[model samples]
Target: MRLAPLDGGEDAETKPLWQRLGWMVAIWLVSVTALGAVAYLLRLWLA
Candidate 1:
C-alpha cells in the first residue's frame, strides 16, 4: 500500500530554500500545537 504517490512532474530541488523551509516550519508548528491540545485534554480528563 503506497501512502504517498510519487509525482513525476515536480522537482523538489527546483523549489527555493525559503519555500522549502517555510513548509517544514509550518508543518512542525501545526504538529506541536495539535500534540499540546491533545495532552491538555487528556490531563483534564484524567484529573
Candidate 2:
C-alpha cells in the first residue's frame, strides 16, 4: 500500500465538510462520557 504525503494541513483542509463535523461529534461524546463518570463517582463518594 502507498502512503499519502505528509502535506501539512492538506488532508485536514480538504476533508469533506462532514468529516470535520464527525470529529466534533466524536469529541463531544467522549467529553460528556468522562464528565458524567466523574460526577457519578463524586456523588457516590459524598453520599
Candidate 3:
C-alpha cells in the first residue's frame, strides 16, 4: 500500500516551517530547564 498522499491531507496543518522550528526550540529549552531543576533537587536530597 502507498504511504503518504501526494496532495496535502485534510488533517495536515498549514503552518510554515519556521514557525514549527521555533516551537520545537522553545519546547526543548523548557524541557532542559525542568531536567536541570530535578537534578539539582536530587543532588540536594543526596547530600
Q: Which candidate's lDDT is highest?
A: 2
Among all candidates shown, the one with the greatest TM-score: 1
Give the per-residue lDDT digits (tens) of candidate 3, residues 1-47: 65677456543468777887999999999999999999999999999
Tens-digit lDDT string for candidate 2 (1-47): 64556656676889899999999999999999999999999999999
lDDT of 1 by residue, 1-47 (tens): 64455663367888998999999999999999999999999999999
lDDT of 1 at 34: 100
Error of 3 at 19 (Å): 0.6
Candidate 2 to truth, TM? 0.75
True-vs-predicted CA distance for residue 25, candidate 3, Å: 0.5
Global Cα RMSD, each model: 4.8, 4.6, 3.8
Kindly report which residue pairs in candidate 2 clash with one another: none
- Badly placed stretches (over 4 Å) of model 1 are 1-10
Order of candidate numbers by lDDT, starting with the best: 2, 1, 3
Better of 1 and 2 by lDDT: 2
Sort all candidates by TM-score, best to worst: 1, 2, 3
TM-score-wise, the better of 1 and 2 is 1
